[model samples]
Target: MRLAGIHHVTAITADAPGNRRFYTGLLGMRLVKKTVNQDDVRAYHLFYADGIGAPGTDLTFFDWPVGPRVPGSHDLVRTGLRVAGSDALAWWQDRFARAGVAHGPVEERDGRAV
Candidate 1:
């Protein structure tokens, strides 16, 4: 079978509300859906994305406010979004900075300034 594209990316979070605030409020992704995790009814599964909650745009999180995971045992991961140009990166940098969110400096990547 062939895969078309990524449907979504899901991660575990220690705080649900905080995740929602960052992803929706700061990042400008819409909170498209809010539901409970299937396996654990007490926890939440939050979905955030661009307009209309389209596939390939979604970033989700499963709430588990219990304990912190050991870092070195697992690979650290980061999510990247494609911006149009350096202008977009600058805009995003300003926005993030205004919101007091720390982010890496914009750099060139794969022949494009990101």
Candidate 2:
């Protein structure tokens, strides 16, 4: 059996407005959809993606009131997104710096420049 790449990822966020702003404004992802959660109507479900709303590039969020996660071995910690090349990485690093976005230094990981 073979596995294809990711179609989308769904995560929860306590601050929908901030999340939307960061993803759309800062990172340049598109807001593909804004809808209510199916089972929980009060909560919002937001979909973000690349241009034209492509499948694999999409990220979904469940807007809910929540607290900081308790760090543990079993829980998910971070999400890593990719760019095209080292030049792009440098450009993003500069952009982040100029925009005052807090980020770690860009370094090579697993033979790939990030």
My TM-score estimates for the predictions, one after another, are 0.86, 0.89
Q: Number of clashing pairs, model 1?
A: 0
C-alpha local distance difference test of each model: 0.85, 0.89
Over 41-84, each residue of candidate 1 has an lDDT whose tens digit, in order, gives: 99999988897777899888899875655778674467887778
The whole-model C-alpha lDDT of candidate 2 against the native structure comes to 0.89
For lDDT, the strongest prediction is 2
Candidate whose TM-score is highest: 2
lDDT per residue for candidate 2 within 1-114, as digits (tens), equals 776898899998989999999899989999989999999999999999998997699889999998778777466757788889888888989989999988788887899876
Model 1 RMSD, rounded to 1 decimal: 1.8
Off by over 4 Å in 2: none
Per-candidate RMSD, Å: 1.8, 1.7
- The candidate 1 region of ten consecutive residues with least summed lDDT is 68-77
